[model samples]
Target: FWDILEQPPGSYPEIEKQYFGTHVSLTTDIAGDYLIKLTVSDGYSVVSDTVTVSFYYENVAPSVETISAVYAIQDQTVPLDGSGSYDPNGDVMTYQWFFVSKPKGSNAVIDDPLAEVTSFYVDVPGIYAVSLAVSDGELEGKPYNPFYVKAFSLLGAHTKLLVNEDIEPQLLPYKERFVVDKTLTDDEVAKEYVLGRYTIEAVGKDVTISNISATDHLNLIKPYFRGWSENEIVVVKKGESLTFELVSPPTNGKLTDLSFSFAWSLNGVGDFSMQERFSAGYDFTSR
Candidate 1:
């Protein structure tokens, strides 16, 4: 018999035991920690053992989080982030950014595809498709669906459209863009929520994001693994804290919730554009 320590005794929903008597297959929408106890006894003797399980059920592929459209000055170096990519096995490791397409007649290119963090310089005014792929080391992960980053003539335009891009697919930056594919949690601490932040460069100019707040209603699903099987499937669940800051605080500040976008106009180009990109939540321990 099995039981969840936090749940009423005998409240363990029936689950199929795996090949090993020590392991079991759980089929439930619930996600969290469980402490299972096993006891065996003959008429004359008895013995017992216990195991604590930090469990979460998720069914998903590695995903990338990022801004939809990026704006940069032609011929100038620009950073791209792919660090937001994630895997369930705590396996996702390396980040690889690619350009699905380049502007016609453009000679722009990403500095290094293998490097976790990289940059690029575009010399033409056109839309380019940029994508990111992650690896769990043993296997390569999926690339974020590609997004476009517009480039304008460096000396010609002081301001340009700040395209309202979606944060679905992040590439791989600083005031400089950032891809926090890494997840850090403090389970030791008993805190209600976990907060996170990222640095975003103002699209049209070199302004500083010293202190600003934003919200990301991004649909982030947390993933978890079971057993030690190399080929085992991953479990996923929709959860985690949203509403992060635009810029990582130089110091800690109580997190606040709000939905907004950053608006800016280019110098020579008088069109206005808005974008809202936020950092991922650090804690994934199902609420």
Candidate 2:
């Protein structure tokens, strides 16, 4: 478009300015229908063009919202999410996650700092702080609310089952009586069998001992950890050794030369099975 001025219309020469490359800044204290032009210079040649910035509009800034806190167990994989953040102007946003604070001496790292959902693991128990930032095409929002994380420890667990020895022989298949019994005065050595039992010790905190079962009640027995306990859950705490006793859960005592084995399991942070075995029968030679 051409405008009329005091100077010759062709002689006003379309007020022009040269920009070295792709961009040029135009500042105007006075706004009106003024002519502005752009030109580029290479060592060998020149190129130029013109465009208009309408006086009616302006650019606006964007903002982000606050995130909440979390609590979890130590040695656990925890998630830090920034998907709650939103841009007011409906501009597409990108996210950046960071570990602003962690346990002392902690070198824990977020699995992916640039992702909307990142994760980290802390073996040390303590409070931590994580932060997130949202970016519009032009600028990043400032001072976002950080997420506070609380990590706590899990108690350790241990178990032990042992066979008891060093007592009267247990392989008593049948009760025996002495031959010295007479009508005047009956003399007899009473035949009896005492089956020995084992004690299973459960040690740990927030722990349960269940699934107690035995391979055999009469022979080759490691206590059955497969089916025992009420609903198979027993809470055992650290420094507290919970012991359960099994005295041959009422089987035929006459089943001689039998080996009995019992076994059970423990879980959480660690997995283990406790086992023990002992034999029983009648010692006929002693008769």
Candidate 3:
């Protein structure tokens, strides 16, 4: 503050301007919560205001509560229970089931998004780890894991065990009718084995027995097969007969160097024991 001023008559007036400081920019994280601040200023003074903002995330995990198991014969359709899952946030949820130890090329059974199955029919016999994973819009939950029942069948052995002229059996033609024998239903001799038709004579210790078939029925049949060599595991093209150790049953008696041979003659009555041929040196345990 200096003095009272006097102006000249033809005066050029000076203008004073007000200026604010810098601009304010805001940002947020995946949750979309934001803190905002405003700057107000003249060239000589500055001030600020505080504010907040909200944002949302779209992806979320799904929730799984329970699963149900349905039983079925091999190759028959079975229903699965997926009623244990829900989207709490009201988002849509997806479902999937899997066989963890499935054989090669069987993954297509459950890979379809449209394979709406409450239970999947199990045709092969084995232990299977079943799993279901679900997802909602914002998140996906952990998969529920469980075990489902399964069984495998011989290539061709069924209810009607077909015997050759020499009382030997062949398993190739009647595979579809064979059901896995959990109990010793058909033959005490082959109580724990899978069903297969063979044209071999019951050579060493096992006796030749009568055969029967189950028609349009859900029945478990105890079955037996002649020991197979590595070469006989599957037909080979220009390959030698295999001589691998027989995968012994849980019983003590085991067959080794088991090999398979085709019937050379349709006329001569083949040895019934030769139908399911086993090596001479291997021990076979009875269940």
Candidate 4:
């Protein structure tokens, strides 16, 4: 059995006691000093003792680490991550994200403001500043620096043609042209491929072209080259060929011409330099 000899000067939960037992339990809803007296009897004699119980509540703010910068394409969803936040007292945290700045006349909004990992759509091509604050139900911690997201537009041209329907189906021929707006050093021009073209021929299909060893400025300067066919599958009869042309600026120098002529069908791509040529072939039939 037990008795509350003294307690803080406030209303609290009722103490739970078992009269037939030797001990009692007390639970207090309010935090403060509590005085309890316990009396125990063994059918012969009784003894009493007093004890003081103390309860304290203290909360510490949490810390957060957010992304510094993010680059994304315009008209796309940009993801923001703040899962690195943590409470020093090991408390469960809640997230609150908001935008500090955005492009003028933009109406972008976060998908979920209270999510640790959230996303927002980029409506315009500009910089968007976002901020995150995390709370441990008691204290909130805001980031020192706002997160930045830069959205940019992609500019390019694409043309699709059928072998016998789009144009005369002679050896499928394509041409590409490029203009350099910024000046670049010779090493920079050599390290990157400013243009790429690809010609995909079906398996067991034969393609023929005149002048198998024709050399052009593309073979001499050997600007970078990468090629890919359209997503749709293309079927061509024997003696038919497919051609593609991709062009991009390399430097501010004079305009450069690139061309290739081969008698056999190429199944893959190749990288060429002044010293060596590296090529990889992919069998489309396996795909």
Candidate 5:
């Protein structure tokens, strides 16, 4: 016959005797289809229920495979690529990519439209890293796959204006006109700033003059200076001179001595023109 089982056999909360049913140990001796009952009582009423227990192992989650920069360039387009492993249990699959700045192996990735994309651009320049994450909707995989990105440096530059011109001093005698030859070199012709000097001597008693001087007109090509970005003009002189010297500088690249020169007339009399057009092939070491 089976023994009767009772909870709180001592009938008190902290009694020295057993307050519940005795511990039972089953050692494969119990047969199939045995009916068992459980009861709990606080020395007044009783209540009962049944429960089942089970255990098993679960499958591991999928992980990230690889993240890399597929393409990169300085002035052109760039692309990044990513790949990973996913669980085969028909679980939800997701892919994410990121660029972490500090604390290596950080999961905090930059959220972007290309995060899930296999390949994308670096567009700009700088050092960077790419990380890939693939999840199987369950336990996340171990370390995520990361790739390094290298960038090339930019080389050439494009500028708009250049200065090339020279200035020479020529002293004239009283009542007589004379032309002074000035030589300019490549270095002088390529300068953006030039200092031109010319000497005028009064012929008749330091005559009171208005609009009496020589001028060297210069036409510059693709000439620009300071904030100005257009054709440049090198004006020699606009008015009179009395034993005076004129100094002028060019602001643009068009003033190369080889491509520019001057012709002059004092008091509307004798004329002095450039003996020969300046040559770009001239040596600049002497100047």
Candidate 6:
């Protein structure tokens, strides 16, 4: 005789005396534990034994979906969306977001690390790599590739003038201008100018200017003297000045003429008109 002692919730094979046999085979349609008992009798004596079987299904991890890249201005809050992630088992899932890498000196952090959607402020101007993973309470799934976020600054130029002679060099009044060709974020537009400075110093006999800006915001700024490349840039920050030296010191008892011309561009795009054309004549008779 064969009897089912315990079984999962579902219809299972039936055992009856009319269908009894020395050996019986049973199969279940559901995935769970099953217990069965078998007994044999010769007239007065009987022997019984029990067996247990179990079925298991593997759990699938959740799938993550998001954009590959994002672009924005510096100091702006970039949003991250991972609401499209789903679990194959229809299990409740949790979200986890983290930064794989970021620019040097950047302290950007996600607003809500465990939220399906979150955002972070770009502290520095550079590329930031971000990653996302989802948990179905059992298994965790990560995207095949991480995403990138790029932050850039608007174009800006600063012009400085230097007058050098027998006396200590003097830095004349200078001008600064920032150009906006593309749309700007609310924070950027409100501030009108980003926080940072670029400096260009003119040195040596050829009067070549050198880019001395500490940051990488300004890709290139070329200086031209009378529509020619001095092979240099003329830029300086507030409270700072550029120094220019003539090929030869002014001859005594003579008037020397000095002038400079240059054009600048931010991130190597859109040439800006020469901000200043400085020409001056000084008498070197005293020297």
Best by lDDT: 4
lDDT of 4 by residue, 1-41 (tens): 77777777884746665465455567876668888777888
Order the numbered candidates by TM-score, best leading: 1, 6, 4, 2, 3, 5
Pairs in clash, predicted candidate 4: 193-224
In angstroms, how far off is 79's CA in candidate 1?
A: 0.6
Query: Which regions of candidate 2 fall more than 4 Å away from where they truly are?
Result: 1-62, 142-144, 156-287
Span of ten consecutive residues with least summed lDDT in model 4:
278-287
Instruction: Tell me, by TM-score, which candidate is best.
Output: 1
The true-versus-predicted C-alpha distance at residue 138 of model 6, in Å, is: 2.3
Report the C-alpha lDDT of model 6 over 1-287, residue by residue, as the tens digit: 78788988875755445246766667666678778788888899999898886766678999999764744556667878998888887889999999999999999999999999999988888888999999988899999988787665422222323333322212221332322222322222221112212233332112223322121122222112221235446443334444433222212223332223233332232243232222222211112
Clashes of each: 20, 36, 52, 1, 17, 1
What lDDT score is found at residue 218 in candidate 6? 23
Give the alpha-carbon lDDT of every model: 0.47, 0.47, 0.37, 0.55, 0.34, 0.54
Worst 10 residues of 3 by lDDT: 213-222
| Model 2 worst lDDT window (10 residues) | 169-178
Estimated TM-score for each candidate: 0.41, 0.35, 0.30, 0.37, 0.28, 0.39
Model 1 clash tally?
20
TM-score of 2: 0.35
Q: What lDDT is obtained when candidate 4 is compared to the true structure? A: 0.55
Model 3 per-residue lDDT tens digits across residues 179-226: 232233344554333223333322212322222111111112212234
Off by over 4 Å in 3: 1-60, 69-71, 103-108, 114-119, 152-287
- lDDT by residue for model 5 over 116-212, one digit each (tens)? 4444344444545666565666665534435655433333211111122222221111122222223343444433332322233222222222223
* Model 2 whole-model lDDT (C-alpha atoms): 0.47
